[model samples]
Target: MSKRLFTTQIKLLESNPNIEHVSERAISYKPEFKLHAVQAYKSGRAPMQIFLEAGFSCYR
Candidate 1:
């Protein structure tokens, strides 16, 4: 099977405050976002919920 490429719309993430950097293979989120995600997870928030709240999407 072919490897799935990271082809999400980079422009949409470029303006997100939670995002520190966007590259062809990965996304770098800000430290604050990392903390927030962890806290949210501990608080029982779903992973998808945390991502959506931080302006991230799983769809391509």
Candidate 2:
């Protein structure tokens, strides 16, 4: 995904407490969360896999 799209998606996931699809525009994220997710990915998890395991739903 493009940087813009990827950023928007990450923001949506951070803002939502439940697993749901986000159709809106860019969303916001806490700095701590962004750090955690990056750390998780660095610790041997696939990028998408980490988010999926964290309970964020992915839609096509």
Candidate 3:
């Protein structure tokens, strides 16, 4: 996705009260890895596995 769309989506999520701690640090993910992270989240998998599968070098 384009940077504009990504930022807009993040902004929309941040505005929702249900989305607590919706900061950059929490939402930040490389574009190339975002799809994997999203899939993991949808599958109710562990965060660590999600991050790793998403190709995040450092997940902690």
Candidate 4:
């Protein structure tokens, strides 16, 4: 991901209530998986939507 978008996503993740409630163990995305998520987020999708559309269990 580009640095700008990556930073934005980090901020979004940090602020999101879903991430705040979930444990680290629930967020086990792989390297390529992360690339896909970032790609999705960069394409006008919300940071939260990437996780939801990708079926990450931590998203709940």
Residue runs of model 3 more than 4 Å from their true location after superposition? 1-28, 54-60
Provide the lDDT at 50 for model 3.
Answer: 65
Q: Please list the residue runs of candidate 1 whose C-alpha ends up more than 4 Å from where it truly belongs after superposition.
A: none
Estimate, for each residue in 29-50, the C-alpha lDDT of model 1 and write its tens digit: 9999999999999999999999
- Residue pairs that clash (backbone atoms under 3 angstroms), model 3: none
Residue by residue across 1-60, what tens digits does model 3's lDDT show? 323333435665554433443454356434545565577688898877764554433422
Q: Least accurate stretch of 10 residues (summed lDDT) in model 2?
A: 18-27
Error of 2 at 11 (Å): 13
What order do you get sorting by lDDT, best first? 1, 2, 4, 3
Decoy 2 TM-score against native: 0.52
Q: Model 3: how large is the Cα RMSD against the reference?
A: 11.8
User: Residue 12: error of model 3 in Å?
Assistant: 32
Give per-residue lDDT, candidate 1, residue 51.
93
- Per-residue C-alpha lDDT of model 4 across residues 2-59, encoded as one tens digit per residue: 2233332454454544343223333334567678777887889987777766553352
Tens digits of per-residue lDDT, candidate 2, 1-60, equal 434455446555656654333445444545665777899888888878866766667743
- Whole-model lDDT, candidate 3? 0.52
Write down the lDDT of every candidate, Cα atoms only.
Answer: 0.82, 0.61, 0.52, 0.53
Q: Which one is best on TM-score?
A: 1
What does candidate 1 score in Cα RMSD to the true structure?
A: 2.5
